[model samples]
Target: MAACVTQQNPDPSFTLSLSAVDGNLTLVQGEKKNITLHIERHGGFSEAVSLSLEKKGGGGLPSGVSYGFDPSVASGSNSTLSLEVSSGAPVGSYDLQIKGSASSKTQYAYLSLTVQEKPQPGSFSLTVNPSSRSLELPTSGSVTTTTEVGIVRNNFTDAVSLSLESSDGSALPAGISASFSPASSTADKSTLTLSVASTVQANTYSLRVKGTAGGTSKYAPFTLTLTAPPSPPPSGPANATLLRSYQWLQSSPEGDQPAVEAMFYRPRQFKSGVNIPDEEGHGSIDDAGAYQGWDVLTPPNGGKHGSVWQYSKPVFIRLTLNRDARLAVVWRADPSKVPNWLKNNWSEQGSVRIAGSDRRVFVKNFSAGQTVELGSVYDPGASISQNLETYWVLFGEKDGTPSPAPAQLGSPAAEPNKPCPQWVHDQYTTEVTMPNGSKRVLATWHPQVDPVYWCYFGHDHGSDPSLFKAGYKPAFGYIQDDLHTSGVLPEGHPGFKNYVWERDGYRWLFVHHFGTGAIGRVCRQFHSLQVAVANKSTGEIVADLHINTDFGPSTDNNTDLPLDATCPPEVPTPSQVANQSNGERKLHVYDGTQGSLNGYEPWRSDVPGNILGLNLGGLTFDTVNPITACKDPGCSSLMRIGTSTGETRLFAVATDPNGPALSIDASKAAATGEFYTDIYGKKLLSPSDPGAVRQYIKPGLRLEVRNERNTECFARDAFFMFYEGCALAADVPQAFMNIEGALSDKN
Candidate 1:
């Protein structure tokens, strides 16, 4: 067996060799190209080899120019090499060396890449700061206003030439002309000067600014609202202030009677009626007896007694004691109390016995020592003998002896508890522990101003803009998204119950109350986190601004918690949309996508290839494709898009909590529970109104864009590649679950 045997050659120590199928490539900046890299295994080497690029020396690959291999590890012998150049990359030639190695043996190959200037598409774009601007020009002379314009481009960088002119069919006022500084340049920004002759009409003018670079050209719309100079202030002493007084109704009967415990504010000088003194100012009259239910003293025999007091001027007041002395009557002692008899209505008052209670006490004129006899003070009418006996003992006799008790009073009319207006509820009532201790109820009969406003405001950490940006949790609530989207709350659903408007600069919040369920369990509860303000000048409604406090976690027994001291940064980001305009705003929040319900992220495009392309350089997307990232419907109408780092990047839209994968739509107004920008400037919806949601999102509603929050973020070109529904399940993080309460099947 040894004579003819030819031993198999020993496996050679692997020697690796690398070569490129194509040794050279020519590409433009911001372009991506691929080359085939071949690995040769010699001397019977069969093990896999890993490949990587090597820097020649002194300098590395041009800034933002990168490469990678398809098969990162060479399995057999070949792999595809991918080279990419960023849009901002400088044009230059590069000599790159790639290396492949298996075992201890490595081989190298050379690649020559020629990078050329990126070609500009046939279109370029321009953006003007403050797309809508205003200027005041005097009637006698001339005036000048300036706006800055920026050139916008993608995958291209060249000197953009500029031309300014009046928009089609919208010429500038007759004498107005436009000019640009450095008419043509490669700079990103340019100043536009507008000069208006006194002869120009004072009216809004539409203007257009066009930019041309390479072979591409684009234009932007600019608005110039010209108005006459403001008029001088009145030269005389201001008009006498209207001494308006606000008297709260402390107690109201099922049927009409009179307000109990009336109080008044002393008149003071004021130039404008808008600002009212916050404190009680001063109380002039007292009506304590009316603090008790006024129905008991309804003048049994149809006698005028417990009636509303409408005081127009300073006057004498009188009080009458009932047979039992428990009932009292407050009426005007002087006829002068009537300012205008026909127009004067019953006046309400504050109770002096209770520190802060408002009562609807009777106010009417009665002659001094007037002996106004009445039958009885009870609904069924009291006995004459008993009434006389008690009356004699109390009024006739000046002694301290007490009189006999009168007959039991009849119950007031049905539905004794009528709901008060939200504003009234906030001003006169407070949350108090009920007898059963099941839930808190509004103490309607309380005697003090509701301190809820001050308490919540004290917890408003968003007072500082920076802290709000850094993610301060605010004590707020939102309507259910499902209800809002349907645009109509079901008939049996709870209505908006109570809210306070214009507190702390038009900020307000409200709650919804649903009656107990079959098992006597509380069924309905909701909260308004933020409110909207409307522009008085333009009649626009502004929503999407949050000005409030953050609340602590909710327990099974107590859904409402006290305000938290601080909002930690790690907590899920709350929903916050800046008010791009003046006034109150509205927002609808759901449990959040997968319970993380942060804001929306429109920058994370849903397009197939674009999903992963965001991390790579040199990728550009057509922004007009509604399915692409930047292509949300009507995005251009809301904002202008541009880039600064020479990269063809677009703006980021709103985001939701799940992740930055879906984009929010800014073009359409949000329905009841849908997320929305402050589409309507300063317009507000009545939380108490059943139809408020549908009315708020009516398609005919056209609110002016205010941009008060100074937000210019627009949808990136990549945002519109695909649409992600709000119902998409999100990856709920563990930390968020612990903070926002763990989710259950019902949740």
Candidate 2:
């Protein structure tokens, strides 16, 4: 191979080189410097290089001198190194060896480090109070003056010596002297007094305050401005003083009770002759051309009215306080100084302290329901018309009710403490049938409590077993059998309806609530339905069972649509008629028809039916039955007539598509002579066509006529309740109907 060496030179191999960027460096105790090391690949070396440090002669690193690399192992020959020196490090020079190794090849570099002991009081700062000032001097010559200043030490723990000199080339203002109270201090606060003499030039200057502590020094900068004094503000009538006055009336919005409290403000305090507002404020009308703005309250009896109690009258007092000083303006209403009328109406013995500091005021006992005035007379020199600030509080009751006591103000009247008579807590028991054909006695009711009709009105679960124990389940959520036995509807049936129905003998009572629930439980309602077989046929009647307990929003803003989302859309209104024809007329009164077109009527469960009409005598018969049967179509009831006379008229009714109901048919039928019915079932006058009212009678309920045209209806039974329009009205606890023989077969 040695002989063959001439044939080919050994192939070039890759090698790595290491070097120190800042190899030679100097450091002090507690101080450190960064020394970089560079690595290079001479040929094609691409392997990662690892770095470490050691003393040059092969011992461990110097005590307190630590070294580290951001990445101990550098990829592709590159990484940063960090070095630190502790304050306790020995003061000496040392050389460290940095070795970088890659692939079995290693290279070395040197780092020179020197340390020194840490210096005392290494950091310090200074600050001076009243950092700047402006002095006023005469134009001809300077004036002597003195101002108190302060010096503060910051971040300097050791004692500090202070000295002052002109920072700018002003030479301490020619005879101006500056000194600190104690001259030297480690304290945070010290007084600095600066004095300037006459004959010094008026100029702005900055002062340099020096502080030396523990062999270290710092400087604090302060500024001063000196100028000729401004000519005394053109002495005159002290800038037309303006004092505004205010008046507030505390009164109830409805009843005679006055407002419990009223607040007002005083004229804003001014700095001597500065910050004077050119215009009046605090409701002053002084500058307005007409009796407008704050000046409207300027008159002595301006706000007095028959129903108003005057508390104070607007007046202005012209007074002066020593220049550069503040004084109090006390406002007291002495009964001895008030007018007789004011003392009799209001508490004229009260006092209000303005504090004369802040411009705010508050008054209590305003509900005394009386008006007040400041006093009978104004200050000797004060004017009631100009440049005066006036203020007053008045209490009054416009509602005509007597004034409430001061202690009872702002609260409702206490209710009488009479115990409820005819009231007793007692138990009630009844037998009920269960779903499994078992009978049980229910004794959940109070015994001898005040007799009250128990009625459930909203969409809440019913506690009675008949409501849910059969096969029906709640739609909202799982409900316990015991909890569901008390409400009128399942816990969440959605809609607005009140009704009970009997089909094939089985009776079902249902009610719907729209957006109804306890506080925080309000939610949109849901739709529900059920079906079952019914066989019994004995005639039964259901009386007033559900009463209106909740009123909807006073306005129509909250009117919701059909209770069940599956219901049809609303329809247009039907045509009105002056007279009914012999032929059957359509009622157009169902939920999806024109007669119930309004948003409110579409959800009414009480008025849904395909009603037909017929006219007899002066009365019209609008019924769910086209023929003479009241069973097929439910609400076969009589029409209620208005107070109008002679003329016959017909009005359409609101209806729902879910069931059947009745309305009215206005048509002039038989022209036979007058006929009337007494409170009894007897008829007066010649017998006329019974078809007129027969078709409109609601089975057992009857319409008794007082005149020939059935213009008025008389209440005969104890439970008399009917809808006067859409609103329900009750005349007695019971109701009865008188049906003529002719209408007997119509039921």
Candidate 3:
């Protein structure tokens, strides 16, 4: 403990009183002023206290403010202060802290001081050049653009101080101006030109030069840039005018679709007057006439198959060239059989390869943030009767109920009361397939169901269209076709969306895809019915997934299916089909609700032979949160793990009692190996290592580790990474984890 020392009353509002009579504080700026500090002693007083003045919150010296003591300011008490005004200090008011150190103890005190400005001694001036003007340069020549910067100083007493600096480094002419003529700010009046040199370019340019007022000096920077004219493009094969593939956006109720109609044939590259058509499309095209629908083309009599018309817009190229340069136009029907054929080959009065790929215009609708320019290509060709009905293009963003505008039957009018009248309605029919040979005959507002709804159509995961492989493909597959319409809702098309196709036939499609890692191999005849789903490594069924579920012609048409699957007597009404399962969820053979209720269509595809479909007979998604730990009242399987063809994939789950996760396994060569997922989202298994306790695995990360024989071979198969889920699963980095010693023998 030390003895205490004291001074004037300790109230922050007033300056402390000092007892030392001679000790005084001074305020300094341009002039110094005397300040009277009261001195008052209180209890616990000790030896004489020393005094020193400092900036309110700093040392005795603060830029322009410093303390001057009578006896001289020191670190301890009893010292005097003499305030000195710094010459470089700016005019302003400032707080001065007065510190008193009594013996070894000290306290803080403060006072206010202000500095007044004094007029500077010397005078300075400045002058600018060519206020503003324009300069022109040759389109393809080297030109230097410059701005003349001038700094002038007239009235002066002290050597008018100045410096020449620039905002940017533009080329400047040498000693632009001298004392008498040219100007230089640092010493005397001077002028310099800032310049930008042009290469073989054609563009406008801007440049700015700065001139400083020399008297006291302040930074004044001007900013600008000079650009040379834009140069003409260089000539070369790479720079040559290449034919840009044309695009047409033909949509169904959903969006753009593919089409081929009576576009009068004309040589593609005719730079001269109206290019002539190679062959006029049949005049009855709009009437559903001709090969490649040439007969159905608009104004069938307007021109022949090869009529010529000048058009900057690209017309459809109905002809497709195969690897052998064989021009083909192919068309097909579910025919309920797989085959190797073409549309324009082997004829019987007329009939080429069955379901051959069709050569048509590529129509695409796009959103911003993505390239809108794209060209159509020769996917595949298909053969059809002299009269295959073509479809029209529709845009996705437009709003309106889709009007059924099937091509009007041309020459061959429909027979009275015919199921598919030749001229009655433009709608087409597709097959309602079942395991048995039984098929449901269908009629749709969209004639091109397969092509419109099933084909791959959209901006894809891939970046380049050229990377897409060309081939004949079946239209997208939907589980049920009741009230499903692209115009109403977006159904999952295998390619991207559900398109419209006119048919009792199959549309040969070519996919321009830069397919990546694994893809599920789709196949037909699962239970002898066409099916699609993830497959196991052994090429057997592993999942039963589906596109969308639709009710028969909606309330509008009411063209009921034999049975209403989407809205069955067994199930509840539409209002009851909430996220939860209501009514009796009796897994009926038809799910009770057979009528279409306009629902979603899922996307499923196999490389070649595996079917991608859902188990209409067995649908379950736990909407009441099956797992106590999940925190969600949804199906048990938070993640779906399934096999398709030779691999497994992952699928995000929805919160529905009828959907948890699809089960799959490709273990058998004969068995469809398809199964539903177990309702258990989180799995807690014992850790193999003593260092670890419980093992928590995400449902997605879990794989089929063993086959029926309990062999580990199937789970570790590396080829199965192509499964959709594999790409999304994260690889865990773990340490010190041990495995069962007993299994070591198998190694």
Candidate 4:
């Protein structure tokens, strides 16, 4: 007995082996065929795994054979491939290299794919970061990620030099290099603080950083971040240059009544009108008198723009007491129709709304002497203890007075008695200690609600193009996987989330809010992980793509794409699929059945076997049947069927986290939480058999393809064959829990 050392280890182990596989190569010029392959784990505690392949020496796998992985295939089951040749493929047998191992293993092996040549897509990364500010630019050798001012290079074309083209079409300082920040930073980060000479066109401009890496160079992403924001000259009623643009609200166009503007506090007299602090917030306005809550300042029902009282020109609403004689203007809300007699200058656009994602220059104007608060409330993701962490910033007059910036939201006078949490990281944030000795946290920022940052980006990844591939994580919440099929994958279903880390391994992609899906291309370095989404409110991924980031436990979370160019399409290997008829028996199998609502069929004649075979090397899936007590209605539109082994797979529509499985419908899947078990004994996906082959077999615990007599129809020709899902090879090592060898790989 090969005392499988890792067979019982808490961590993962690997064993690589390759073998040539075949099924059918029905392809056209520029098209590829998907073939079936198998994989086995020498030792590891994990019962499930995902396998992938890469045509190592880069020319790419043979154009004739497009491959994919399917867990439907037992450890030694078959997955299919498509064969498509390009106009200039070096016809004949070429070695199609493949790589993969069990999800439970830390090792991987190489396999060979044979076929004719054709054009294939490759992948690469170009990243840049660091963005630290120095008093001056360094005068020295090329700046690489290893040092400050990291040089972002073309991950594909390591030889290519970066090109900096500003949005304003201006040139950059010579010798200034661009590169991806170390795993410590993201390419979207400010890598270099460019201070152009006044003589350089000082305008915000579009920027595009280009260069070559690997063997070839193609147009990369248009550097999306703005390089420079326009420096709007300071504006305030105190400055004579700006004072001329105003007309005091207390004074009529015909004359003036200074007393109206001096009810509680006296108003300042500027040359042109009155000098209210543009730097002052409503907080600065004296509130010592009546109108404490602006209760006494409501305008008549009808004001200008349909309000009674409106600002003719200048109306400074301060937050705090601005001066010894000041009347704090809290609301200044216009109610009814304004005196048509008054000429108002403020437009609806001039008013500011404090929603979120408002970190913009426009904020400056609306906030000049605007009502403000001291600090911001940490809209805790939920009403949970230790969830709220309020913070404040430094804003207001430069008088050096002890005042919280903009506004002091919570008891500013007692702020000294309170302290901020230890984890607070704002530069201006502080902690407050109460007399009771309990520590409190107070931090803040002019928050931009739900800021979007990319962890990884790639073009054209999803089965459809509109689906943009993106990976993301929320700043303050856990990602919710709720896509119908995506959210509830059965044990035997072939889906992304269905793939799991072997026992003890805690590894899985955390997608936050990528909207489109996966499509498009940008330069790479698989920089910090990021995801694209449609809307912050919706929280949907655009698409799933091959994204890389500096996370996990190694290299401080830095990850580069594994591509010199867009390497050829990867062909995945076959994996194990379990069958739980009479006993809980498991076996490895291959499956690739990319399906569409149009191709969904419950029978073999409706579709041909292998026709729906997954392109494991590329994008593929299995139509695993659910083994549950679900009460949900089936969608004829999304009805997916499996070419099970004639009749030994469970048909569960629901499951119970603690109770036995139930054979129900969709409606009950989530509501009941029941686990549907299979009493039939059917083997995992295998070639079709005839006659009594399936007589003794029972359905599987999962509703995936079972191997038996009736399965023969789907053996060689089926519209689509469903199987269990496979795991990502890159996410493997991170899945290790305690294996020394597995941990060593990460280190």
Candidate 5:
């Protein structure tokens, strides 16, 4: 027997033992409890000791009770044992064994756990002496309001803590704070004070006064009202009064005439008289004009027959002040009442001259209201009464066509000697016989004389003609080609043809066509031709056609058209090219191509996947597709226009692309801090800019495209057209052909 035992195995190399630091633990149902266990090593035992818990009876575990150890395998001197008792755990004492093993040797410790039913919580109620309180803050000082809070306890004596919070879970308004005399107290009552700083906004607030005792909480409603002090009176004279009115007499070729109609009114006064003259002389003076209020002063003619007296005359209203006073004048027009012709033809036409000064401040578009302060006028001693005159005038033609206004007394107009191109002076009128046997003037290269300049002609026709293709020969001139077939084929054919006509002592090219029903009833099926005029004798190009060829169906897309028929290579006029480097070149006109004349192009499509491509200043820009980028309601009516600066701007509606729709009264719109926003929802002008005035263009406003040279020369003679004529001045990058005509018949 191998020495038979050799003396009992030397005591195991090491011994592992376990003992519970806390032999007993009490846990309520659904509660978690922890116990500490002492894991000890004896006789040189050094290996990690595994720890576990088991019911003494050998059942998996007390029903609904789970156990875990901080260190399941313990190499330290102690371990933590956590036990979780579910709500459904058996309510009884459990004898558990904590086993610790090391190197296959095991040791055990005993633990006792008791699971008990949860105890009931004490109850309490909260109340306030007054449920609501109101306080007013001075303009520069804070205010305070107080309320008494009462706590009623039922089977509860523990201290109850008090806190205030917004009933809606939001933070208290700025500068507002709540405090209690005794923050946490067992007493039945406590004083609650709410302090508000002057900076606190005036409003009604709902607050909750919460009292918490352990896990039991109660709340009382507290209403807080804050009021702001009343505003002080304005510091200035009491009021203003109308002193007198007078008209200035001037002489015209037609004979002597009053420069303006002078009408007097008191505050809120309505006057009935022969204040306005009738254009057709069809109505009695009594039936001509009637005004209700003095707040808004309008042209005496009531905007009838497209005639505005102020356009031809200046009106002065004298005001007398008892003391020093500040005056403000505003210009407004009812959107619905504004004539469509005025809106379509004019950019800005109304203006007011500063009192006792020739300086005139132009008003915004009639549709867009404007306000200006006349500034404070000081009394020039008591002997002489304070008298001031407000001069008002309207610029533009009586027929609603844009024209230059006469220069004021002090400000001289632009130099009128700037001579126009020689060809412009030599051009003669060309007429064609119409079907009615009446001679229609087709090309009046030199029609009306410019109001400002003597040498410059006022009218010419060279621009996008898409809108007038169906009319009689355009104002310029054209040759018809009834021989061309009209139909839509793989190789497109022209439906209507127009050829170059002679003008400005040179053969001019002006080709525009509209598709007929036979070609395609769809507005998208159209053909156009791009043309340039060259001096027949010198082969020098007078106009260079620069338009996006991809805009529409061109000869390139239709093989039937002759490629060689296109305009020759551009050779800019010698003087015009030389002036460009000297910064003397003014306006440039890039003739629209046939494709650009098409009513429906890629940029105008409403399809979802199509991207927007804008042709601006001869350059193309790819912008976000309006169909997808437009998030505002009623986006379908949105329209975009390209600025000469190479930016594509948005309009509120397609029908009124020049300005925002006048949906609100002018006063109300200004009061609400509301203004127009571009397509990107950006404000066009910030009112905060010093001396900045906001202007808007009338919707459906027609644009008359004219070269800068003609506009500049004409503006020199008639100063008012300087602003109107140069509205599109920035669109020109170089001196090109002088084209003048409406961009669209409607909008």
Candidate 6:
């Protein structure tokens, strides 16, 4: 049968073949080309076939190059093959294979592609003047810079289209925009304007300025450097100096008080160029044969005591040293050179006490050039940055024997005879030099001993410590004053007007003051305070309390009463009496609407049915209403009230478990309320002033109250105490219900 195999070959079934309509293809980078792909069917092959393009060598398509078929799946004979080469595609020859498959049968077509770089006309070249630019962006508003793009033409006439792009293929950064004047131009030069918004961040950027014409593109490298604007100048004075001088009364051996001595110590640097001439009975000669010692025992008629010595009209001297430095001062008080009156009543012996330490030193037989040295001006183990050295030289009878040598210079004084009480935790000692050069020592155990110290620590636990036992604590507290000013809206702003007083507008101003006098530490300690207002009826939080001040530390000190030596009887006394100088907050009372003249009208007092418009007179306290005094940290229950006039007061009231337990009794209001006393048992409010009242309630207590618009509001006024060894008690104190009407207010 094998020998008889003369059978002719039969036609194959379903044979598929593929071929390109065109021959080898050539394209420029970034160019797209399409060619027809013919699928030949043999022996009536009609089954659906899929088409795909792939590299013949088993590698990815050339970088940035891609290929696709118009009809990826084909039952027809013809299909279009589209090939695209990106501008960044590699310039090289590539071999690709077209694959076609159907019903487990496969066919292939070969393609040769050549990607070439776009041809350059060489007729024109692009050149940008100032290829690199640097600019400082402002904090607000926009800035613009310009550069000229020149086209060096060599027989090129077609208009050139100019454009810009990031060299790294990224979009321009936010806040940056660009424009080209004469966008498509035959002119030699075009202006390229780059605008930078304030919002743009500072950085360096690489960019390309492209000029395209006649299917050719020319690129010019450009660099953009942006820098942040310089910071604004400081608002306060620079290198301002402060000096304090002190005065002391001196008695003579004859019992005549005809002389007074003024003493102050400053850094030795300030002594340069200062000349104290030798005058009979006025100055003493030092070992160098110069009148280098301070004036001693001047007669009362010479000049008023305590007058700070200044090198210039307004310039004073001060020095700051580290805690480890020993503070010392030098002075020679020659009794023989005293004035005639002082000489007649004075003796050779003298007594003196250091200011902060109260360490006494005795002197005898003063010599012409004998310089006395007072030891360290601060106590041992003090943590102060600076010390105040004051010499109280008295010419009266000496009660102690003179030391063999003057007190050792720069040596720490002996421990004081009186030690701090054992119950005083974190018993620290600090020295304060007044604006008048008077020095005082403050200790936590006995802050009341120094007037300046008491102003900061006294009454810190509220008007009465017992009030804290009832579980009632202060929630929020602040001080406010009034400001009279005027301003007009600027052009392009809503409600623009010329010469309009701010007070005449629909909004009212809320001016809050913080820190005053020597209590500038208050500003430093409580730099920022958070406050919240809530709706008492539903216990819902409403608006947040906002004050328009930086709340930074204050530099105001005791400048008005420079020579006053008396300490205040209690807290808030001298501070309230002193001029208000510190931080201030000015806020406008308006609805949250922008650019509307009548925005604040809704909150005005003239508006009817507005809870904020209700007229609240002086607070009329109920004498019989008992209040609980908190004796421990965890007693529960507190009340607060805030008025439209910027006055806030805290209180604790008791009633049945439910039913409007804490609220202002409008029915019991009066034209003038009774005055309330402060923690020191001193009357702080006057009956005649019905606008507001003030009080400090408890330590570490926080209270919350509704805003001026709400009918119900509450607040707690408290101070924070910092004691190293004091820990909060675990047991809540028993409620004392007798202090029902005992409310505290702070204006």
Q: What is the C-alpha local distance difference test score of each model? A: 0.32, 0.31, 0.25, 0.22, 0.35, 0.34
lDDT of 6 by residue, 1-747 (tens): 001101111122232223321334555666787778887665356877788877753346668778788788987888888888897888666666667777645555556565556544556666565566667787799999988787767667889999888976577788888899989989888999999999999777988788899798877666787865643423442111111112222222212111112222211111111211111111211121111111222112122222322111211112221111212222223222222322333333322221101222233333222222222222223222321222223221122211111121122321111222232312334454322344545331122111111112121121221121222122222212221011111111100000100111111112112211111222121121212223334433222222222322211121112111222233122234234322211112112232211101001101112111112121111111111111111112212211111111121222233322222222322211222222111234342343223222222222321222112112111111111111112111111111111112221
Taking the candidates one at a time, how many backbone clashes does each contain?
Answer: 74, 43, 169, 217, 5, 29
Whichever of 3 and 4 has more TM-score, that candidate is 3
- The per-residue C-alpha lDDT of model 4 at residue 341 equals 18
Best by TM-score: 3
TM-score of each: 0.20, 0.18, 0.21, 0.18, 0.18, 0.19
- Model 1: residues >4 Å from true position, as ranges? 1-123, 136-143, 154-158, 169-171, 196-202, 212-217, 238-747
| Candidate 5 local lDDT, 265-332, one digit each (tens) | 22222211112111211111111011112222222222221221223322212222222222223222
Per-residue accuracy of model 3 over 618-699 as CA lDDT, tens digit each: 2211111000111111111121111101011112222234442222323321122222111110122222322111111112
| 32 Cα displacement, candidate 5 (Å) | 99
Least well predicted 10-residue stretch by lDDT in candidate 6 = 492-501
Off by over 4 Å in 5: 1-391, 394-526, 533-747
Q: Give the lowest summed-lDDT range of ten residues in model 2.
A: 1-10
Cand. 2 TM to true fold: 0.18
- Candidate 6 lDDT score at position 72: 88
Decide which is better by lDDT, 4 or 5: 5
lDDT of 1 by residue, 1-747 (tens): 001111111123332223322444445567686777766553366778787875532246778789898898877667888888897887655656666666644455555565555545633456565455556677577888877786645545678887766777344557877788878877767888888887777566767777776676666666676655433323442211111111111112221111212121111111111111111111112123322212221111111112322111122122332222222232221222322321144243332221122222333232322423321122122221221100100021112111111211223211111222244333333353222233333322211111111011100111211111222122222333332344332212221122222212222222212111111011101122233333334434433332111221211111111111122232221122111211111111122132221122111111112111111111111111111111111111111111100111112222323333211123343343322221122233443333222122222332322111212222111101111111111211100000001111111
Question: Which candidate should be chosen as best, given lDDT against the real structure?
Answer: 5
